[model samples]
Target: MTIKYPAGGMVSKDVQPVDDDSVELTLRDHPLIRRYGRLAYLVIHGEPVPAGRPRFTRQGHAFDPKRSRDYKKLVSEAAALQYHSELLHGIPLKVDVKVYRHVQSSISKVERAKRLSGKHRPIVKPDASNYLKLIEDALTGIVWEDDNLITDVSCSKYYSDDPRIEVTVTETGAKRPNNLKEPHY
Candidate 1:
């Protein structure tokens, strides 16, 4: 934590000498582990899929073939990237997700559009919420102890020539200085 003061504030330049062991000067209120922050990120290229709709068989077996395949691919991509990043255990996190969908061909029918064309901002399907489900499921065992630990999430969908999904995960309450129990003295 940094403190900023206006000119002529009460901070004094001199420190008066006191009896040894008579006083304690504490700069931080919490352990340095509170400040240790880590960011785990990955970008999956190709068409993104929503959490698959479940299909039940006559034998009462349920499955989501399409979404299962998609999550498999997504998880592999995330695992490859997350292998080098720190795994967050029971820590509240902030998840930022961005989905870029392939531009549809129907926009061509509309004519005489300025710089604010479909490419800059395109209307697409497969709700952002669906993407969240798939992503959260895929990342469960790899990045965190459980999906319930996520305290916050932000996600959006967009149009792009190269379809992809980018996920950025941050440990929200973690502080800096990796060694938590080390004595400052």
Candidate 2:
């Protein structure tokens, strides 16, 4: 799915396109996260290395502690800057939000089942499709504003107290012509 930002203004930015195929990749092998061995790379270090840096330098080369610290900070800011530019240009990101609640059990079937069946069969687990329905019921809506200047999303799940995750995306900082719209995700 593609979402464009700044739907009305002449200026817009194209942030990272959250793709179905790449979601797992982003969540698992994200370069920034993989580099530091923690998810806090962006949140703690600052910005990501330039897209071209990896091509030039070995991904696992060791650097001086001081140099590593400085470069790490630089990349974090770059990431934040890119996101802001995308917002100003009205760029949108594709995102999927899911909320889950654990189910409570009130039954003791192990002893009873074994006695009734005369053979101890493995326990059959209930499918999660039913839980997915609950999550679907919890989804409310997504909103984007001012041609992507600001995108706000709220849901029924947001109404209660749950640990919510907010993901802010920025454009790649590639400047377009004065009178052109960047490609949509």
Candidate 3:
């Protein structure tokens, strides 16, 4: 039998021949496969915006708030700069997102120093999950095929003078361990 590669290379092997006598392996050199097991990094240079609650109109239609939409667009643009084509699909992924919020100007110099030094973190509203939600939705179709493929995620928020969101994505090679214990019943 003959195996044909996408790069116009053919290799003859002593294997069972199918009816066609030629086998074409398409995914061997796919872009996603090439990027598998590697890390993808991106930074959105601005204040990190968390996913906002959906707004409903009197007509019973649901829509993302203007702020949320704008933030998602910004995130998508940032991700697009790093990845041009071939979104990852059907692969487990690990995502780490760090959100940096600007320190309040009203705080004292000592408090500002503490915030900038990472000694004082942001413990206010718009939790980490909300930030992750916006990032995941924005990255969909640009970084990966779907957000559900992300098997592991870590998110944190901090106060910084130069506010931004840093994202790192890696394709997990194998099934991740599920730490849930079986029910004793």
Q: Each candidate: what lDDT?
A: 0.63, 0.29, 0.79
Give the poorly placed runs of model 3, Cα more than 4 Å off. 1-37, 173-185
Best by TM-score: 3
Better model by lDDT: candidate 2 vs candidate 3: 3
Q: How would you encode candidate 1's per-residue C-alpha lDDT over 7-120 as one tens digit per residue?
A: 211212233433344234231222332354335666665677777677889999997776565565555554554344345675678888898777665655343142125535
Q: For candidate 3, lDDT tens digit of each residue in 1-185?
A: 65443333333544453243334434435444466634567777767889999999999999999888888987887677555446778878899999999899999999999999999999999899999999999999888889999998999999987788998888765843599677798
Off by over 4 Å in 1: 1-38, 109-124, 173-185
Highest lDDT: give the candidate number: 3
TM-score to true structure, per model: 0.61, 0.19, 0.74
What's the lDDT of the predicted structure labeled candidate 3? Answer: 0.79
Against the true structure, candidate 3 reaches a TM-score of 0.74
